[model samples]
Target: MSYDTEHVRNPGGAPERITGIPTFTELLANVDLASLYTDIYLSTATTGPELAETADVSKKTAYEYLRKLERAGLVSETGDSDGTRSYEATAFEMTFTVSDVEVSITPELVVVIAHADEFPVIERVLEERGLVTFALAYDLVVAHSEGNVTVRQLATLTDLSSGTAYDIVEAIYEIADLGDDDAGPTTYSPNDVADEPTDLLEELTDE
Candidate 1:
């Protein structure tokens, strides 16, 4: 007797949604919090139970991922529904403060920017200066971009040690030609200083 094999219309009971949400599309290329954020965001729904079920993750995992989105101010709680909380996807506006001014950013805007497409071209700067110095460099650059920031404030922003902070300020001075030769305190903008050559310090040493 010959046996007939049956072909099922759907295998494994339908395709399963992918796990892990990404915070940013670029992050998909790497394993990072951004990617994790994106994954959970795509999987979850406004309904708590539905979200938990869709992500195929425990409630705790769902909550944690949701919290990350909340902290970034990308997600907001819509309101309570049937005694259960509900959330809806909101457009992510890339907004941040520089100096005392607020700036709103958009994905399309980032795409057109010369250096905005990728994150952290300053990794090498950090490697050379250590985490503290790298952070100082980053904050100071941001301040410069925003058009105003004090050294002390930048220090706090970057969490740099006093000595490290001073060094960063000096480095900016040299880069922008606002050295002691200038009458006023050296002030620079992030946009102006952010594009320093990767080998700037090295090149300076060879001179």
Candidate 2:
């Protein structure tokens, strides 16, 4: 996966824009497909059989998801010489702005969504709270990890109960391994955005 730093920081900074992305509804509804997409996104390039094995799905299912992803412009064929079709996921950062709030859908969030089955809290949040809330939770978790926000502040801003906010932060902490100093490098972070939710909320509330 490749991303230009300037393009990530400011969506308009890119020379070319990506089209034909799947709708958020389509993305959130297909967890298994999202998992396969994440697997491809994390790798340099991979074949259908390799993805099938990694995601524990049948070859047919893997290929089906890959076709869907290809149609959505998320993955592209790498033209392997061995006659096996390999693919690479497109690196992208899509920001949706509604009123004063912005929600970004990046590879990191995709990983979080893909691992929903492995993380009960993430699944619970997705099933109950919905994708927007989950994205906000992820941002808040990042803010908290960086000491920019507190659990009470998260609850206040998001109207979630303090306990719920704490749980969300903890769950994201484990999922993203924010506490692990040895955790590998990541493409996305709180600093990647021009205005984090905490800052936006602070300005809105005059905090």
Candidate 3:
């Protein structure tokens, strides 16, 4: 899967879209919160009870998390004809720019964060390396999936040991398999960004 370069950079001008770093970080750290958010995100629309059943939590727990998600701008609530309230995930894109490089967190990344407990390597990467590196790792995993980079090159680019890089690759494969119900994982490549420095280009080009 791939995203339009411009759409990913700006997402959209939607007022409901979330772009704050703090909010993104807060959501990323909580597995249950992330799970509830993803269920809404990947669904057409769902209610608190449905979310609780799908996420294997109680109704009260689901509504509580739904409120938190609504407050964070990750999900929006709508009323049903029977006076029941349904929730849907909102459009969101969290992006950070450093110098000339920018990384936007994708929905697939959020799914991975939600299921991080199932993959120790991925969990470790997020816990130790933080969000930026985790985003870069996702890109690197996509590059590897497309045969654009090898594990050794991934290690060089990420500054991770080869063993850890390989583990991440395996973990990503598992995550992608688990996401068969949702949109397949998409990627953004730094190479797609034009006029980057010669040395940076050379590094990408290097064996």
| Candidates sorted on TM-score, descending | 2, 3, 1
* Model 1 worst lDDT run, 10 consecutive residues: 108-117
RMSD of each: 18.6, 8.5, 8.6
Per-model CA lDDT versus the true structure: 0.46, 0.73, 0.72
Better of 2 and 3 by TM-score: 2
lDDT (Cα, tens digit) per residue for candidate 3, span 3-45: 4575464535543554545556766788877888888888888
Error of 1 at 6 (Å): 68
In the range 111-134, model 1's lDDT, one tens digit per residue, is 222121233333333445443345
lDDT of 3: 0.72
Judged by whole-model lDDT over C-alpha atoms, candidate 2 comes out at 0.73
By TM-score, is 1 or 2 better? 2
Per-residue error (Å), model 3, residue 48? 0.7
What TM-scores do the predictions have? 0.28, 0.72, 0.71
| Position 123, candidate 1: lDDT | 30
Tens digits of per-residue lDDT, candidate 2, 1-207, equal 445584364434435654556543456667788788888988899988788887757788877888878877888998885788889998877787766667788878987787777777778777887768888878877877776666666666777776677777776777678956664222234355344455656563363
Backbone clash count, each prediction separately: 16, 0, 0
Q: Where is model 2 more than 4 Å wrong at Cα?
A: 1-19, 182-200, 203-207
